[model samples]
Target chain A: MSGRNATIEVGATSSALVALIRSEWGKAWSVRAPAACLAGAVLLAAGTAFTLANDQVRAMQTGEIPVGTLVPVAEILASSVMFAQMVVVLAALQLVTPEYASGQIATTFLSHPRRWVVVLTKAAVAGVLGGLTGLLTGPLCVAATELALGDAPRATVPAAEAAVMTAGVFACAAMVAVALGFLTRSGVAALSVAFVLLVLTLAAPAATGKVFPGVAGSALVSGTGDPYARWAALLVLLAWVVASVGAAVVSVERRDA
Target chain B: MRIDDRARRPAFRTFVGTGRQSGPVIVVPMLQFAEISKRYGPVTALDHVSFRVEEGTVTGLLGPNGAGKSTLMRLLVGLDRPTSGSATVAGHRYRDLRWPLRVIGTHLGGRPVHRRRSARAHLRSVALTHGLARARVDEVLELTGLADVAHRAAGGFSLGMGQRLGLAGALLGDPAALVLDEPVNGLDTDGVRWIRELLRLLADQGRTVLISSHLMSEVQLVADRVVVLGGGRLLADTTVAELAGRARDEVVLRTAEHGADDRLRALLPDAAIRPVDDQCDDGAWRVTGASEREVGLAARGADLTVLHLARETADLEAGYLTLVGDRGQQVDSVEAR
Candidate 1:
């Protein structure tokens, strides 16, 4: 025990969250489970791109490929979002629960004192990491979708607008999953809730549109069955993210650590 | 608020020869508990227990198993909230401190460091949290004598090593006060001695030290003040000397001679005499409230040659056993329900 002065300098806000993000990302990279999941998701997206690229080559030889195939190829990257979200949520759960089970929550609460800050820091890191993965994987899938659907009639919209919209869905889904993780704290519980909500709000709606032929059924999903729903779905996803993350913050603060 | 000079050490003369000490003298307690209470459902864990830890002393929270020792520690550092009470560490609730890790360091028993992370990582996280320079992490690692295995994962470390790592993490901030629960549980003899010295050194620097341990001998050797708890209630709170002074007095005698035991027994028939060995080569006798002089005189009259006769004052181990362990049989029943 050294006789040192006790100096408590608090309220370094942005820097604190940034520090936690870097630390969590570092740990995620080092852990084999998440790293493997990430690799699998990326490989799946790349494989789809390669297949679509082959289709583009064949269509070029026959001069029969259509521009509409580009949209589907871009949607391939968005397909990785669900698997990637599972990986991120599981990683966040591991980060949060170990503190409780191992009794490091005392250490953590002692450090931050404000429990909400600690919970929010974890949520923020998960969101940013998930969002970044979206930005990276989105463009590749778009190019692949474009190559597969070569010479197809372009919609009134530019190709870049569709690709960007597709990327936003991946980011939104990842954000929502991460927030759900903070809300649930248990890996299995968070995964279950995310699956139910994603299936009901996103997958089920699209499946419903396929069965019914009119506006009533189309309300469940955006028109054209594009990988990116219009901004409405993104807004609903953002609302879920906010609600889940806010609930986590409130519970962590009010309940005993 | 800074402590006033008068509060630092109350005028010793005023306390001298004073029969009645009144309430709320402006003294600054290193740690103050105000009507602290906690309950787990229908069971009361701690019932309105209050005590103070003064600087430069080892305040031992002595209790039998499940006497709320860990609960009190958890409350002190914000791991658990009191049902209806407050504790102030250095004039602030530990949780209210801006950087609590730097203000009040604690080592809760059974709360080990991350098994996968190296000891250095464990300490570095805390040090980083407090914004301490990286060197402080190494400083604590070296101070805890863990430098040799600093890079090794704590999972592979022995229980003693885990304990040391926990301590190293707690000490990363060089806190003003230290709270440890059963800190000596897994320590070797040398490790125990090292902690004894370390605690003494910290207390001497005017840092408040509250150590909770069931081992009376360990507490006796380390604590200047002892607070005994039984059934989650404060049983005895006093200095070590005061506790010893209040203990039951007994006289012990050992002798080996022809009919010495029977003669001594017949003279003082109330004495409890138990054979020390199978061969009766050594016989021991114990009598409460009897003086050694009386025994010697009785022996002289009885013509019994005495090999050894001594008056034994009850040590803290005996004192603790009498206060807490005498009622220890009820612990299982209490925890079972």
Candidate 2:
């Protein structure tokens, strides 16, 4: 070893939670996983918008489309939101699984011994990044749709509502994904379970006419369901987020690092 | 607090004499494990094991491959909870410390790092958790000789380099105590010697250093005290010299006069005297329980011309083997229960 001075001073002034949050943020972006997943989501959104816009433009050129057949910006934004939510879920699952797999969680515990603090800090970081991903991709999807349907009377949801709803959905999904990741501590297992949950929640509406809160709430955000259904869906999705995240926190605190 | 001048001096004198200080000493140990027992389902990994590592000393945790050395270290660092009892550093549980790295630094066995992160990024990330200055990362990188490759991905590093990165992470906080498990596993000869010197320097600075290794000779060379474990149970906890002295010591002697062995035997009836070899014509006797001085005096009293006389001192390896080997058999019988 070199004889260079290795003395380091520990700063104990800051709150442990804030330090943990900063560390978690660094950990989330330390690798290419988050960037790759977010980039993939944006690309998927752009491609979907380009394909739909091209189809509409071709129909107008051929003079075969009916007048006022507008593809609303909300519709395009909704599609991109769905895609981004998928990526967020995958990204959130990835955040904790690799640590557990490589046994880096032990080091994590060494840094911040309270398991709950680490879990909550990671969830907060992933949720914020997920929200940012939605914020960036929602407008990109709208711009793509606007470019495709040039000169058509644009129909769209209010900008503020679109931003809030889209980001809220992505953040909630990301939190749920983080919870599943902590519960399983295995990427494959967590991903498998998340996929199953998504399918079951998505199919619940079709099979039972929007009885499931997640489905009803998603439809409300897309502006397809009644106002009462929207309220009920919001409550249901919030409950799911709360339950999933709570269980994850408890599991992590009780289990060994 | 700034590092004092006394803390910077090399602890050569400390190493040469007894591992403790000469003046009035503080009684508090830097690290303590009290009745700590860990059980994983049907297997007991640690059984009521307890030991204190004093400040200004290097304690070696020695055990075989399947022993509970790793489990004990993990317990000390709060990586695992004991099924019963407690482990504390500086009179506080590891989990309760606001800044644990400052109090204790540890490098556990197996890979405990994200392979994809760069060496610098990894250290910085850990540093940020404790609110340490970013410059501390550079300091540790230089200390560990990884400054040139600080930005290199840890996944591509050799096993020895990976170990160095791990040590860098441990030393990042300038902890008062260090708990390292098998630190010399992938190191070369120079790397091994470097660790020994560094640990000695840290101990001399009044830092508590505990290293776990299965290599008896390595521990003998560096450790002031050796804590041996076998089958999840502590076998020996004492100074290196005392451990070696625990083993039987024999005095080997050769005489030019014929029947001198009989005369020596007659002189010390309580001593166990045996022939070194029946086939060899040289009359050499291995005598246990008699000092070399006693044997020489007896031979001189008998007017026997002594050709050679030497006392064979037991080494750490032999003493460790004797301790662990005996305990292994007992542990096996207990496991059958």
- The most accurate candidate by TM-score is 2
Per-residue CA lDDT of candidate 1, range B1-337, in tens?
A: 1222323522111112234566444545667777888888898888888888875568899877888888888887777789998887765676666656666688886645555667777666666665677888888888889999998876698888878888887787777678998888899999999888887777656566899986777778778998877677777778887776766777777766654667877777766655555465455666665689978877777887788888888888776666655666344322211
Instruction: Provide the lowest-lDDT 10-residue window in model 1 chain B.
Output: B9-18
Question: Cα deviation of A25 in candidate 2 (Å)?
Answer: 1.4
- lDDT, candidate 2, B76-165, per-residue tens: 888788999999776678887777887778998565778788888888899999888898899989988899998987878887888888
lDDT of each: 0.63, 0.76
Docking class of 2: acceptable
Q: Give the Å error, residue A45, model 2.
A: 2.1
In candidate 1, which residue ranges exceed 4 Å CA deviation? A1-41, A48-71, A143-185, A199-229, B1-28, B255-283, B300-311, B327-337
Error of 1 at A223 (Å): 8.6
TM-score, chain B only, every model?
A: 0.82, 0.77
Q: Please compute DockQ, using alpha carbons, for every candidate against the native two-chain complex.
A: 0.34, 0.40
Fnat per candidate: 0.40, 0.61
Evaluated at residue B317, the lDDT of candidate 1 is 75
